[model samples]
Target: MNSSLTLRASAAALVLTAAMAPAVAAQPDDPAARSTIGVHARLLGEKIVPHKLSFQNTTVGGLSGVDRDPCSGEYVMISDDRSYLQPARFYTARIKVDAGGVHSVDFTGTHPFLQPDGSVYPPASAGDGKAVDPEELRVDPRTCRYWWAQEGDRPKSASEPVIQPSIQFADRSGAYRGQLRLPPQYEITMADRGIRRNKAVEAITFGAGSRVLTSAVEGPLIQDGPEPTVEHGALIRVTQQSRNGAVLGQFAYPLEKIFAESDPSSPWPPDTGVASILAFPGDPSRYLVLERTWVAGAGFKIRIYDATTRGATDVRRMDSLAGQRVVPMHKKLVADFADLGLSTVDNTEGMTWGPTLRNGERTLLLVSDDNFAEDEVTQIVALGIR
Candidate 1:
């Protein structure tokens, strides 16, 4: 289903609450599991002033993905603005964290993502093929360059054209360097069996000493069964590629049902998908997958699942997953955003590991995309992980 439709449905039932309460730790299913990581999230008491954090002469909102620059203490965030409000761009910001929790967030600067011809994306209009829908951003651990994902647009009608999804690299200054050559399965086609609209590649991460780059689609390809529902779940492919863009392997990750039967439903089944993925600090095969959902009247539901491809079957060679016997990654629930007691969870989409706090624990940061709506707020929350 289209994300814009989901957002519009959710906005109709918006309910505001007080500040978020401290998060309660969730006990792992297995107390002695070393392969799994336990996490507890607490909403930062102070926000970055929703839809008002400006940098480089633009209001910094619609943050979809965020990662901390290893070299600098600053954090980089990608905005999915699609060159509507401004040219495609990213922003650098400072996030303060301590024993209590995330203290504050401040914007430092913004840089425009350049096209091959060395120009910012032109404003969206008819015949505008240069515009991009930037989704996730990551700083290359090897060269400190920035790699971001674009969930290219899918056509709405027969006359509308399609955009191909891509993962491109940019210098620290946001100059276009190159892009990864994606598999043919990811291409948006006029055929019915392809990436659903607004549901292309949305998550990307570098791991294995920065030798391996992994990207996951926001939902299953049209041929891969159906979108997850309260009765049955769906499967999405996670592709691992070399830094130079060669496909290495691909595995399946099962998406849980969008919502329970008791929860609210809309004209369309509320969509659920992997919003972001992060490789474990020392394990290339392990990752923390953030899955989020937005049901019309029920609001949002987000969960962090610790997943491993250690023994999962590689499906890269398979032409279609619809009827294949594939082994999915092992996943365990790590944290549920609802348990954090947030007043209202907006469109939470991005996640990354922040600097270690003074309390000697690893910090995890999650950001929300307010969709640039006045009724919603851009929220940045921090979680303490042991």
Candidate 2:
């Protein structure tokens, strides 16, 4: 199911809460997990401030892969449809956060984007080794062009894998201009171990100025589940070339660096680096990596990491995301429609940084991936990064 699809009005809130439940619970706890920095909170110390922003979920189309425009302050989200699987299209919306900290998101329209042949680039029922799924999206800080990564299964030995990474450019009106194919350098690999594992890529962002960064959802292979633990998500840097549009260097986040303080035998794995990565504007060297973990049964934990120092801190973790929680302007509820409706999926796949709320206050935005289940409803949440 496409997460962007619409539902009946009465069922909308139910679906949204249920879909968000697992993702909200994925933020598991770690007794050893420590934090030196402090930030204010809501929901009896369960919620943060920036989430007060509101979004108008559209009924006309399915949307995913949301990103914030650095220059315009507008939010741009894309709906991935490879022919029948998903049509290659983009959505443009303007988000307004009030002085009192009230928030709202409006979906303006859908921009139809296609491949070279004018047909959808990634066709549904795509075979192995084919370019079909578009997983992660990012905006270039310098040129403002949009970049998306293809996440599909690794081609079998008998099937050939077309390892091509590409970027898309658009005009101010959100019109498609051109695309440049990125040359593949490094394939996804395990942290302590070295081998290409899970082929799914969850999120992408800009890092260290003009550089690009991304995280794989799971290893090239799945553990017992379809995804990896927060500890298994790996971060890597991508270098682009001025000529021939080549991807130069690929550096995976060293697992030892992330788990340096954790007990070696402890079952609580380090962050799998799922969710999304955000490189702060103005300061590129500093970035925030989000990891959502489901440690025991249903509770969740969300952590923020300082990429420059390779340090991390827990932000908010709760037993239920849909239950009433105090934000800023009002009391709010987080509901995961999926848990109550269909497949049990909790995924926060989108993240971006926007203009500051106050004079010196920084803003961070996050959206959950509903995976388009009948009971799931997608949500766009915001935060003020201090």
What TM-score do all the candidates reach, one by one? 0.87, 0.57
CA displacement after TM-score superposition, residue 104 of candidate 1 (Å) = 1.4
Top candidate when judged by lDDT against the true structure: 1
lDDT of 1 at 97: 73
Worst 10 residues of 2 by lDDT: 326-335
Clashes of each: 0, 48
lDDT, candidate 1, 73-134, per-residue tens: 89999999888888889998898876676678888889999998899877556444566789
Position 347, candidate 2: lDDT: 47
| Model 1 residue 269 lDDT score | 59
TM-score result, candidate 1:
0.87
Candidate 1 global CA lDDT score: 0.77
Error of 1 at 246 (Å): 1.4
Off by over 4 Å in 2: 1-64, 80-86, 99-102, 126-131, 156-201, 207-250, 254-273, 293-301, 309-346
TM-score of 2: 0.57
